[model samples]
Target: MVLLDVEGMKCGGCVRAVERTLQDQPGVQEASVNLVTRSAWLRLDPAALDPQQALEGALEALRSRGFSAQPRQSGVLSANAEPDRAWGWWNQWRQLMVALVLLLLSVLGHLAEAGTLSLPLIGTLPFHAGLATVALFGPGRSILRSGWAAAISGVPSMDTLVSLGVGSAYIASVVALVWPAVGWPCFFNEPVMLLGFVLLGRFLEERARRRTGRALKELAALQPSSARLVMADGSVRDVPVEMLRPGERIELLAGDRIPVDGVIEEGYSAVDLSSLTGEPLPVDAGPGTELSSGCLNLEATLVMEVRRVGRETALARIISLVEQAQARRAPIQGLADRVAGRFCYGVVSLALFTFLFWWLIGSSLWPQVLEVPVVLMDHGHGHGVHQSLGAAAQTPFGLGLQLAIAVLVVACPCALGLATPTVITVSSGLAARQGWLFRGGDVIERSAEIERVVFDKTGTLTLGRPLVEAVLMSDDPSRTIQLAASLEQTSRHPLAHALLQEAQRLNLPLLPVQDSRTVPGAGMEGTLADAPDPLRVGSLEWLRSQGVEWPAHQRDAVEAAQTGGQSLVAVSLGHRPIGLVAIDDRLRPDAVTALQRLRSQGLSLGMLSGDRRQAVERVGQTLGIQTDEMAWQLLPDQKLERLECWRQSQPVAMVGDGINDAPALAAADLGIAVGTGTQIAQDTADLVLMGDRLEALPEALGLARRTMRKIRQNLIWAFGYNLIALPVAAGVLLPGFGILLSPPLAALLMALSSVSVVVNALSLRLP
Candidate 1:
């Protein structure tokens, strides 16, 4: 699979166009284009067997289809380096500037000719006609070209709609000027006003559109440009990061960024991983510790051997994931895309029908059925002497043509095109800034439909770190623990950490162990240097296998703590049971409140764990989770199977932070990863909470629901606006109330519609 950056993708229709172009090519297996980020991730057939050839073929296909595409990774071939680019903003600004001036000129001239004021060369037929001509072919030239291209391609865009409307108004005005017998109302300012408003709206919308990719751009910019290369003789040279290969040594100083993924060979430091993980805490690292790119080294000088470089580094992988997720289409967006795909064709057909209906069907009717009044529009230029001063003064053909221009001008595709993508882009950017990652709009769509949330106990709900809750049933508890810690000296288990931490706290002596061996699912066994018998620290069942007897007095407390879900590790010396360690993992500080908030929304909540039944039940009860909703002692696959079963009825989201939970996270309808968790967990998750706060989960959910709501509302308004405005522009109400929409008024309404959608989308800033 390869990721490519695509340009000129404005809406869902553009998404379809690019995908269709790429997918139809030979050797291409699939193409998914994202409108929000202007990128395409393509999967190709392995049987074809040539990456360079395939990429070049794909690029050529897209370029021919009027698109600009290039591989995001450096050194890859882009068949055409200079794909057709639209006129730059400076040109657009110049066009808008000219259009604005001409529009003002026409307005002033109209006012002067209306007998309200005096202004020279402003509102005459000759001057206004000349100004309208410049506006049509000048500032509005790109719109006309793009519209014509889309129409010829059989997919009219928003540009096509505006082009037709503006061109029609200008043509009608010129004909009226050249031939008085046509007797049409010559409103030359209509085209100038329409181009001015359209250009200004495009300029503003493009600026907002660029902001949607701000997070991705920032992520890309985080990569270091150079690294301190350490030579074999201890000499150092600053070299470009791309020149460093795996296994090369690099020197990192205090306050310097780690240039690539590497393993430390010397020194120690507290590295600030906040930029990479979204957690504000600095992590302590020492020799033998592995570090990824994009971390800041604080307060130490260290030397490390590089392990991964370029796209293979963790930072690059994260950037790639974020970019792809930004592009992934949400379920709601698919519905919007389907509509946008044919939206232009529908608008054009309706405009034509309106023109025909007014000219052929409604022309025969008189004042009762259709009022063609005595008034002249004054046509923005002085009316001929034969024209009346009262309303509706044009001939039937002239009235019909005027209404047609209004129909074309009033309908806008910009609202529909901008509706969902703008909101998705802005909301995703907002989520990124909050230390939460919404992988794709689809996750947001699924999150909005979430009915059940399943959480993994260890790390996800609890801290995954166990503490010594209580110690009992022995004359010499400290001695028993010191002996146990000796056996667990090399183990990294959470239980081992609990015992060792307590030993370290009291400065207990640890005896050396010889012939230490892991019992696998039981515990550990080893011989102390001075002891004749083997020392064993393991489960209660494992100690019984060695025939160790437990004290009767401690059984009740053991049962009580077990019922409360504390982990028990028994110590046996010379085949007799010694004192036990009661260890338990505490729940996260915000777990209860976060769970309560989710429940308040009427969502079903559940927990899954590999812990014993009693332990799982105790934690579930404490968190208000019912017995039926909780699953216990399950393996990774079992957790996945359970999620698959639950999702059959409703959408389920799995939250986990362990390597064992990666499968279930990937299997669920949506997977949310806790940032403090394992790398595997973060990779598998569709949504990631980078902060150590569980409360942020609820906020992320609300944001997705709200963003989707905005998308739906925008779609409704866009569709409804056109359905009602098209007929009115066609003079549907003319026969009853003699109402006909003027072309200039229709142009203003069209511009306002685009502005409303853009403003509504921007309103999705997190509350």
Candidate 2:
């Protein structure tokens, strides 16, 4: 996968175009583009990919589509050092500042006419007209040229409609100034005001985008530029980190960031892993301890041999994964993009109809149409001097032109285009902070659809390792303990450890047995020599099936242990129950609360375990799990089958941290892994709990659900805002009521509409 910092993407149309271009290239598995961040993340088949070739090919493709792009490389895009990034932001501010000055000049001209005041050598008409002309051809040149060129190319954008709105207002004002016989109003402030508002909104949106992408940017910033390369002669030289190859030894100093993934060769230090694990505590590192890139050496200088540099490092992989995940679109986002694709043409056509309706029809019926359309606008008619243009706003053509301009300026597809991508990017970052990492937007969508979550028994819901809970026997059992310890001392199972530890705690000595032989499923058997019969230790079922009578005295204790969901290892002397040991894993402190919270949110929860029915029931009862939701003694294949069955009814999420769970994880609709799990399980999971906390699971689900909600809200606002604002901009209210939206006001509202969607998405960060 490769991540590229893209530039010149103005809207969602630009995102779609860039994606289409990149995905069409060879070896490209998928291409996801984010309009908000102006970034593109690409997935490729490594077997067929040459990174340099693929990146160059993509850059050329984007260039053909009118976008500038470059693959993100470490040390090149530091916020303080990247000239292009700095200049990009500075350019936006400069344009907006200039537009504000031009707007002020235009406003003053209107004020001069309204108050019948004169200033300097320039009169009202020339002064206002000059501001409008400069605003169009000067500060607004980029917008006007892009809009005009897009329209000519038959791929009009939001800028195109804006250009038309400002241009029409300028042309109308010029006619009123030059050909006064046409009886038109000279509203020169409209164009200047439109430019000012659009630029301001764009600047703020860019700032929001920068904040949203701060995490990925921070990740890139973690890459160090220099490393102290330790030579074979025991001398150190400062060299560019990238210049150091694998197998080279480097000297790491206290307070210096590890330049690459490597093993510590000598000395000791505390490595801070906050960037990767989200934990603030530093881990102790010594000889042979593996250190990943992006960690800081907190103490003592250590000599280390580099293993992986550049993109192969863990830090680089994390950044790439996050960027790719954020770039991919959710299913709902496609709807907004489709609407935006045709939005420009639709608005243009609608504006034309608005003009024809008011001029040819409505102006004749309503006397208000004979007056200026907007009340905020002043016609300068009260000034007795420049009455040469006739009664201002008395003509139907002039009033109709204002309505048309309003429609053009007010209809914005930018909001619809931004509805999904912004939220997804922000949500991805937010999830990372909470110690959960999603592989892609598809996982987030799948998470939101989850109706049932299956939890693995041993390590998932409970503390993985077990502790002895109780010991039951039909007799004093000292001999039983001695016999059981002799049979199980050599074994390394959890139960065997428990038995050996118990005997040691009691200071009991083991008696050696001769002719010892191991049973496959049953416990080991041997001639006790001292005992009256051959001793046996295994599961109660195995003993019972072998004709060993159940001990009456220990039956109640056995029932109690079974009901408590503990593992039982029974010992027999000549088929008579000698002793029983109860062992079970402890429940996590947060497991109950987490499960309760999940249930409250309408998710069905279940326990998937390989434990027997009695043991599984005990844990299930304590965790508040219902009988139907518990599946016990299931093999790995059976667990996969359970997932399939559950998924058939509704989307199922399987949580496990074992290699055995990998198959079930792959089969489920969603798989969540504890980071402490085996590499196979974590690799199979769609999302990882990096901190290995159970509570973070619910946090992830909640974040996904909230992200979906934000997407829906933004989509609704984008669609509804356009639907409502478009007709109003077309003077729908002008016929019955005297309400008319001026082009300048329309532009301001349109600019705000997109900003509002972005702000709303940002609000998801709260709570």
Candidate 3:
């Protein structure tokens, strides 16, 4: 995927044009353009095109469409680099100031004509005409140029409507001034007012739009551009963060943001992770504590070995995911896009129809409209004509033209285009700050619809770190543990760690074993070098399958252990029962509260695990899960099958944190992976709880539902505003109540429509 900063996109039409241009390029699988971010994300086929070539081609294509495009830098933020000035706030402010000056001059000319004030040459028609001309060619130049370019390229946007509205008013005024014999009215102030309102509205709209992306900007700001590198001789040198590589040590000072994801090698401190995980309190860090980039070291200095840098850092990944999520269009947005794609063309046609209707039939039906004395003019000595409206009624063309300009300027396509993406962007960023990384808008939508949440037994609901609770041995307990530890030391299974910890606690030395192998969902086996028979340590079923007989007296003890939620591992030496090791895993501190929250949200909960039924049952009862909702003694494939069955009834979200849960996670409607899970599980899941806090599950779902609701509200407002405002602007209420929307007033309303949508989306940032 590649991100490109695109300039000169003014509305939904521009988004469609850019997307179409990029999609037409070879090897480009998909292209998504965001008006709010002013960026395009392209998914390319690596096999079909080189990365450099594809970028150049895309840039060239955008340039041909009269847009500026550049590849976005993916490196750590560089303080020395200049900020983006393509659409700088200062530039917008300058344009708005120019329009304001022109508008004030035109308004003064009208005041002079009304005998309310007297000025030297301000009241003159020629002066007002020149002011309007300056406004059009100065502050409004970009609008005209971009509109013309879009029209030439067969993709007109909101700019096209504004340009046409302002240009038509200016031309009609010029014709009236040049030829008074035509009986037309000269109103130069109309054009100046229209341009001024558009410029002012856009300035305000841009400010609100920028605020919607505050979360992403805050996250980006947390990345430190430089780090203190510790040389081999124990001296520290300041260097760029990008220059640091794996295995290199970096020294972090107090109150400094961590520059890389790594483990603490020396010293200790209380680091502030609130910026990354939204945790209120700082967490203590010591030697061997894993630290992620973008966290703040609150006290004391520490040295950390760089494990991941650049885009590989946790902060970078979160930023990238947020960007992708914002760029991804929601499924519900398809209807809006389809409507906005051709909205300008339809608006232009409606403007033409409005002109023809008012000119041919409406003016004849209500001739009094022309006699309302709206036209203002200035003769040589500050003398004004209040009779121009009546005189211009004979022509009727000027009256129709004025109404048509209102129709053109009042229709807005930007609101519809921005409604969905702005909300998605805000919601994604909000979720990220809370430690939930939603992959895309589609994921957010699906997550909101979840009816059931099925969680894996170990590692997901429980802490997953089991401890050696008891040890029963037929011979010597120390000898049995030593033999088992030798074979288990080579495995990374949770049970292996438990046994190793116990061996270390007892200070027991392990015996060497040969040809050790592990069976999935079963156990481990190896041959002792000193013994002729093979040694085994696994589930009771696995031992019995290997012809190892369990003593009648031990059956009662093992049953009691299993029934008590303790997992028993049978030990044997060549068909001879050695002993039993009972391991027990505790539930996660937040599991009970998280599950209860989910259930309260009208979602059914279930648990699936490969552990013994008795053990799974004990956990299910503690969590309030019914017997029918719990499944145990299952393999990886069985978990997938069970998840599928649950999904058949309703959309199910599967949460897991082990390699064994990857299949089920991928198969579910929505896959939520624990942040501490295996890389494969995280990769296959749709949403990842980056903080590994189960309590965030309910919050994530609630945020998704709220985002979707915001989207619906925005869509309704966008569509409703256009539906009602268009007819009013076209003079639908003129014949009934003599109410006609002027060009400037229409322009203001159009701007407000878009601003309202964006502001509504920004509300998601609020509490």
Candidate 4:
């Protein structure tokens, strides 16, 4: 699927060599070469060889054969897909060298003829003509072999035409030289000059092809050469990272990258997490915290147990995805493949038609047609009413040459083959650099059409870590706040962190309470260090058992907070009820601005959270998510079901972080998981936001839209190139307009068409 412009292909032999190299790969099922077009098509499996790898294999094969190829850039090759072509510079250099030698000999022969000086015996020879033939037959022999084969097979291609025309002209000159009676005009110099010029074009083409293939090379350059291996028994040994296996330990020195994704078993240091998660901030890592490859070790030596190896690593997986995307054949490339297939058949038909048409109309129709030997000699140049038919109108080689040239020039499927892959490759590479990895081209494309954004409440829209908003008081504020914060500090709950954070922020002096006991659903109880009473914070039933009076006003405040969806903390001192503290969770700083941008893009934002109704409403209102439009206190499964229900009429995207949210994330047409969310949630989601910012969501959607537009543009150009070139190559306009396209002109146009498609795809950079 990788589009490449290869050069150095001069004949069928060269084509076969390149094809063999690609077919050797396990994933490459087939490879087709159009010798006339100087292009090769490869179909591969993403599971085996990725696009970057495939491209490298193809380019190296061409180079080994003395041809240099590159991927064509958009506009530089095709407006849609670029032609996998090679520069003609190598051929040009060889031709130039030949021409210089030939020119020197021609001048020497001219001088020897004048007898200005006595020349050596070697100088007496006709070196000009001899050297000219050598240049045409040696390095440039591939064109001759391919062209001769087509003409003899009667399935003449561009090669057959150019070869016949040039060969006929050369042989005619030789015939005249030997016989001196069949006065055939001498155009020997033209063939020699044409050979030189053609090689120049080929060399230039080969160089361009080589340049375009650099995308894969650049991608492969990202992996490091070796890894630091941490052995057992506390000793460290250096080993090649590729040789390391799963379950092995790797020690990362300061400034080294974490070689594999693993947990820090025993170490503490400020580590740079930028490469793995795209988070620029350095995070402190200690025992039990996991890390991925490419994360830099900044402060301390650490041990990381290897969890994945080689291609199984996260960085390796990302690289694989991008490579596969580049090599993938979209529907657009198939059109080009079909057109080139048809064009191959069409050219052969035209060659036969040209040969037959002349036989039918000529005066010596029977004798001249039957007389192969005589026709081969004089080319049936007998004066019979000055018969003008087909090749007879020009030379015997003229009509067939033109037809073959048309086929070769018009049948290049470079434009069709290159359009989509080139754009995808370049864009995907850039995306990887930016830390936004797209799973596939189609996902990137579909993201552009999103009209509404749905955020999962717990881990997506909010910080997931609930922080205490305010502590409302009724009777005894100290007993209420202190008891609530202290009990939470001993528990392992998200709400506990919120309570502890609130206490720390307010600088509340923590009491040295003893025998602290948790009541599960009710709350907790403990004895204060200097007080005679045991304090208790629990439900009303628990308070009632303790003989505490539930004041109507305190009950009213608790009820109001509960109705508003806030969790209430009830306090009791000795056997009597005290004041209560009502705490609520707040929103993250970036949520409002991101939601506002999504709204501007014509999206109606809604939230689905398991948090209490009042807590959900507070966040929803703060971020402009309509309170009426929200679904509060929703379980993970319920959230998924709600999204499915909403999808009956429109596309729905669910964003979440909790394990409960996994099913919902999977059920949504597009599921976006926050990086801070649980592992299972990220695994279930279609896209993972690697950073804390939700704003990247809108940008990703925008990139998807641009990618789709570019794909469409490339498809159009791919189809359009063939639509216009096919009929013209078939000589459809010749009878009416007398406008027959020359072989070279057709070749140039075919190449230009592919370049146009590639260039069009590159325009994804716009907007």
Candidate 5:
């Protein structure tokens, strides 16, 4: 997948155009454009695509849209780099300088008229007003051009209303000057004021937009530029990761990303798998072990064969998942679209009705008695023909024009289009930086509403790995372990590994054994050369039938192991009882903290595992969950059944990491798959946690809540602005309360709301 910075993108249509252009290129599997960020991301077939050439093609597509395009060298690959800050600041400064100059001139003109100026030359008011016009028309031509295009096309965008008001006001003023009115002249200063004020808002909005894009920039910085490839001669050479191939050996240095997923062919070390699986534990590896890409090599040098490289690697695929998820649009943005589409029609209808009502009133005798006659008598109209006509037209035309300009200015719908999506975009990006992958805007919205959470035991609620805790013997401990090792050596089960590990720990040596055989369901049977009969390891019933009496102390140890939710393995030598080995699984490091945070969020946390009742209960108690909150001895289907039952009452999110948990993952309202689990579990889940830490689940939930909050705020602001401003711009309040907004003023308000939403979203940092 590739995300390239592009230029000149302005709206949804521009985004669609860039998307289509990039999709036309061969091997480009998918393409999306973020207009706000001025970027285009592409997923492609690596075998058929050349990265450098693809970027060049994208540049060509952008140029066709009338904007300069090139690969941003500093942050070309990262989604989190803010190399665009320099350009963003430049864009801001250009707008600010023009607006500030205009503002100074307008304020000076107003001050000069009030006799506040000491120097007449410095207060050359006409020249300042004309200079403001030049600033508005020349330096700020992009806004005018975009607005004019939308207006001419009859789209009636936020741009259209602003253009209509500013352009009309300024042009009318020029007309009034070139051909001075035979009555009171109109003022063009409002248009200048609108441009200056709106530009100030744009400057604020641009600063925020640039900050939001930095999340992507930071993500891009994580890529490792070079890898140390181990050559056949046993020497290492630094090479670019892109140049590595399948079957080639690579040596990982400490703190380096595993360039590709592969098997460890040599070396022994503890590897930090947190970055890849989110698992906090460092896995110790020796020869003939699997190592995934993006895992940090934390110990001795690791030699691994590259099985998957470039885009086919696990790290690349995960990056793709997050980038795709971040591009999803939120539901609240639809409200903006609805408002923008109908705003023009609604406002025009009201304006027409107002005009008709006034025209009808003019035809009535009321205009002569209440308006025209009053004006004529004030100017003493009987004295001159010019005097009568000027008084009749001057006051009314000037006031009506001013009111129309105000209405058009106040009707800009920029906020209606920007509010919700901008918030979603910025918040989602912030969440992504913290390692939460929100599948879509709805997940962020829905997750915030979750009230209950169900956890799968084994890997989720407790540490899943079993360890040998104790070994008890009825006979000589050495003789019993040696015999037990011989029997267990032939069996394949988790209990077997525990037994053998315990035997090894005791330094017990296995005597030469013959006729060694494993009874599939029963256990194992084998005869040592020194033994007079076959040694057996099976159930207590089989041992009793062999005339073996259970030792009292060994019986107590077995019972104690069961109570602790541990596996008990019994061994026998000849016809006599021997020893017992107790093994149990441990809890994860972050389970307690995760549970506490989820509980704080008002989610009822419960544990469900396939382990025995005692084992599951042990884990729940250790994590501070009450006995009523734990469920055990559940198969995959049973887990799903429990999840379904809970889902009926409230939204539930199931967090698990094994294949057995997949069914429940699918059944839950939101399936949070941990990164450390099996392949099937990762594929089956709806939302994959990039790390193995259960703590991330609550972190993600917190981030999701923030994102949803921002979305709601943005939607409310956008919707509220339209609800209030649209009615006033359409003159709904004019007839009764005389409240109306000009087009320039409407545009300014719309832009302010849009910028506010984006700024609010950008405020979500990792508190």
Candidate 6:
């Protein structure tokens, strides 16, 4: 994926043009342009073309089409760095101020013409014409140039409409000033008012967009620029964070943001992780505690061994994910994009139709409108000022031209383009802060539709740290445990940890094992060095399949273990039963509450596990899951099949934290991985809970629903505003109620339409 910062995009039409430009390049598979972020994300095919050449060609294409394009800086920390804009906020503010002065002078000219003021020089046609000229070539020059360039490139945008409206009004007034015999009205005030309103609206809209992206900015700000590197000789030197590498030691003092992901080697401190996890209180940390980048060391000085740095840091990954999420288009957004792609052309055509309608037919049909006052200056006393409709309508062309300008300026394509991405961008940042990382907008959409959630047994609802409770069916219990621990020592299964811990507690020596192998969702088996028969250790079901038999007398022990909610493992030698091990894992502290919360939200809950039916049933009863919703003694593939069956009825979400759960997770409608899970599990899942907090499951689902709701509201407003505002601007209401929207008023409404969509998206940031 290639990321580029693109400038000069003014609306949905611009977004479509940028996207089309990139996607048309050789080797480019897909291109997405975000108007809110003013960035482009391109996916390319490496086999078709060299990536470097493709990037250069794509940049050249954008430049040729009149956009300012450059490669975006790599790394999450760089996102906080401001881009160098030729016309920055201060320059834009100065331009707005200039336009404001011009607008005031023009308003004064109108007031003087109305006889409310006695300023002869200010009311003169040449004076107002000079003010309009400065406003046009000064504050509105960029808009005109960009709009003309876009039109030449065959991709007209919102700027094109504004330019045409303002330019035509100026030129027509200039013609009247040069030759009054043409019978045209000279109203130089229109252009100045239009530009002033456009500038003001853009200023406010830019401010609101900045606020919508605050969460991403805050995340980028959490990484410190430098770190204090601890030398081999115990001396410390401050070094740039990017220069640090794995195994290098760093020193952190109180109030310092952690520069890299590391493990504490010495000292202790309370670190604030609110920026990463949204946790309110600072967490206590000691030696050996794992610390992620961007957390603040709050209470004491500490030394850490860097494990990950630069783009590999947790903070960087979060930022990248958020950016990718914002770039992804939702399904509903496709409709908006399709409409916005041709919206400019359609609006231009409508404006032309509006001009022809009024000039050719409506002028004669509604001649009464000509006598109606165009401004406050029109009254019983004829002032002979051309500002009044009666004077301007000396020819029907004047009324038609005025209404056409309103139609052109009032139709907005930016609102349609911004409707979805702004919401997705805001929600992505918010979810990152809350410790949930949604893959993209599509995942957010699917997550909102999930009607059932299935949880894995171990390491998901359970603490995943089991302990050995009893050893059975063996004359020498110590020998049985030693044998099992030797085979399980290298495994990551929770039961393997239990057996190793038991062996450690008993201080038993493990015999060396060879030719060891693990069966997923089952057990481990290997050969003891001096043993005549290979020692096999696994679940009774797995061992039975291996020709090992359960003794009739030991049935009582197995029953007792299962009734107590203990998972039992069988040990066999040469197909002879040796012993059974009972391991028990406790439930997570928040499991019960989290499950209850999910159920209360009208979502059904289920549990899938490889444990015995009795143990699975015990957990299901405790969590209030129905018996029919619980499946036990299932292999990884069986779990996937069960998930598919559930999905046949409703959208199902699988939550798991183990490698065995990866298949089922990927097969579900939405896959939610626990942060404590294996890397493969996290990689396969659609959403990851970074804090490993089960309570966040409900929060994640709720956030998805809320984000989708906000998107719907924005689309509705965008579509509805255009539907109602366009016709009114074209004078559809003029014949009925004599209500015609003026060009300046149309400009104001158009600016507010885009701003309203952005402000609504920003509301998701609120509580």
Model 1 per-residue lDDT tens digits across residues 130-238? 8878888888887798778767776567777778888877777667667868667676677887788777766776666666666656665667789999999999999
Answer with 3 or 4, whichever has the higher lDDT: 3
TM-score, candidate 4, is: 0.68
Looking at candidate 3, the ten consecutive residues that score lowest on lDDT are 374-383
lDDT winner between candidates 5 and 6: 6
lDDT of prediction 6: 0.84
Best by lDDT: 6
| lDDT, candidates in the order shown | 0.76, 0.77, 0.83, 0.58, 0.64, 0.84
List TM-scores for all candidates, in order: 0.86, 0.83, 0.86, 0.68, 0.77, 0.86
Candidate 5 Cα errors over 4 Å, as ranges: 1-96, 105-129, 151-155, 182-186, 254-302, 344-394, 472-492, 500-515, 527-547, 552-565, 605-642, 677-682, 724-750
Judge candidate 2 at residue 669 and give its lDDT: 88
Residue 81, candidate 1: how far off, in angstroms? 11
As for TM-score, the candidate ahead, 2 or 5, is 2
Clashing pairs in 6: none
Model 1 error, position 244 (Å): 3.0
Model 2: per-residue lDDT, tens digit, 208-289? 8777777667776777889999999999999998798999999999999988989999998898877766765678999999
Model 1: residue 283 alpha-carbon error in angstroms: 2.9
Which of the two, 1 or 4, has more lDDT? 1
Instruction: Please give the ranking of all candidate structures by lDDT, highest first, separated by commas.
Output: 6, 3, 2, 1, 5, 4
RMSD of each: 4.3, 5.3, 5.5, 9.7, 7.3, 5.9
What's the lDDT for candidate 1?
A: 0.76
Model 6: residue 21 alpha-carbon error in angstroms: 1.8
Full-model lDDT, candidate 4? 0.58
